[model samples]
Target: MDTIIKFRFLGDGDCPDWLLAEINTLSRMTSIKIKILGQTVVKYLTEGDLDEEKVRKITQDAKVELNDAKAMVAALELIFTSSARYAVSAADLSSELQQLGLPREHSAAIARLHTDHCPQITATLSSQSLRVSRLSSIEVLSCDNSSPFSTVSLKLKRLDGNVENSVINISKKDVHVLLTELRRAKSLMETL
Candidate 1:
């Protein structure tokens, strides 16, 4: 069954037409319904001299409907002008991932990581720190069973091992140098 999700956008003042268009485009792509609230709806209802209390009451009542519809809330900050932020309740994304048949623990771990660290293109675990290679690749490596300092070395060895590359023991201080050498090697190989 397709899950129907709703989203409410609260704007500081009269909402821009472009913003509404963008939301509509997203809704069309995702098959979700988006509702506008706060000053945007207020302006639509009363062109001038709107009563704040009345708007608040209407907003509260509409919010009840939104809650019943499993809608998430969001706000657009005028200060940012072009940026939009979603107000996602904690674990909401994890729950969605779980529903998609992902292991609960793994989903929770990924969600927590996303909350703590912004999206990475290409990321792999090396030692205790993460090695992010691209913003779009967000891959993770775990050292759950390896020795403390060998984790990153193990990763690098695995990556290059298929071509008969020799393994190297890595210290924490050697990570940068190792990455630089790896990059140079890759560049040289590309030219061959």
Candidate 2:
């Protein structure tokens, strides 16, 4: 009803066969169990990685195959993370999951977890993501030798609030190659 929410993780809203089968297992779970699993998913989302020990415990408790449990967790992680990225409302997420064949109870549980932890989830996702270090500055010093060389000093600003500095002695040909590459990268960035 609300703009037909599309989850790219679900591949055009058609749930994968593997996930559809896993949903059956999830649907059969008790509400408490589903809530616990949803909490684990939220933890995984906030932490930006899965806890293997937690997954093992979940498999043992759910009495499902290890791979199946993993599949379910992975699917739920992608769904909720994608939903968060899209800024989908909790009710919309629930409806989307139901449309994807998840039971109402399970969808509602997952949506509730998302509603409770959306800010944390989004924050962690933004902070923990891998991004290219930014080049703060570059300085080139030329040697007055028969065979000329350049001392290149680079300052890089990393995502974690660290500044890294490096110095390289480069031949003239290498400097030309580096400039060409930098020009190419600049062109590509501008095109975007």
Candidate 3:
């Protein structure tokens, strides 16, 4: 038992219902016991007797996990809605969060994470076996316009959180094929 760190969340708007449920479950676990501080406050202690350095390290680790969870939830909410097929920009998502009544600091943190880390995430998700029903959206990544044969890479995140980074080996014939597919898609939609 180390006195590393104790974390408590007042079950208010600061803590979401889902997180409260997670906290409740954590309260029941054997090794790490969560203490109910009051009617609306739930607290968990890491260990009973950790030194100061260990306490700092453990607290930092916990903060990292919390930040990751927050980023994922915020990203999913913005990028994976029922009626849309594309992931919006972080700035756009931040504005949305503000509209939803989240504090600016909270929304800005998520926005910064989305802009900074989401490109890698999008690339990873696009490479997976994601089954999206609607037309795909591309996160503009990079283009090699300087080369004799230019190539472009796009990152995509599917509705189900799968990521992919696809590169197009573009040439004249490839351009024609792409145009043909676009025309076919337009025709099919017109028929419907």
Over the stretch 1-192, how does candidate 2's per-residue lDDT look in tens digits? 555545544444645577667777777666667778778888877875667787778668868788877877877787777777778888887887787777788888888888899999878777666445544333343433346787666554544567767676778668778767766765554443
- The lDDT values for all models are 0.35, 0.71, 0.41
- By TM-score, highest first, what's the ranking? 2, 3, 1
What total of clashing residue pairs does each candidate reach? 7, 0, 17
| Model 2: per-residue Cα lDDT at residue 119 | 93
Worst 10 residues of 2 by lDDT: 136-145
Badly placed stretches (over 4 Å) of model 3 are 1-85, 130-192
Give per-residue lDDT, candidate 1, residue 163.
Answer: 25
Q: What does candidate 1 score in Cα RMSD to the true structure?
A: 19.3
lDDT of 3 by residue, 25-133 (tens): 3223221111111101100111212233433343344443444333333333333221022456666655655544444655465456455555444454454435333
- After superposition of all CA atoms, the RMSD between model 2 and the true structure is 7.3
Q: After the best TM-score superposition of candidate 2, give how far the Cα of residue 89 lies from its true spot, in angstroms.
A: 1.0
As a TM-score, model 1 comes out at: 0.20
Best by lDDT: 2
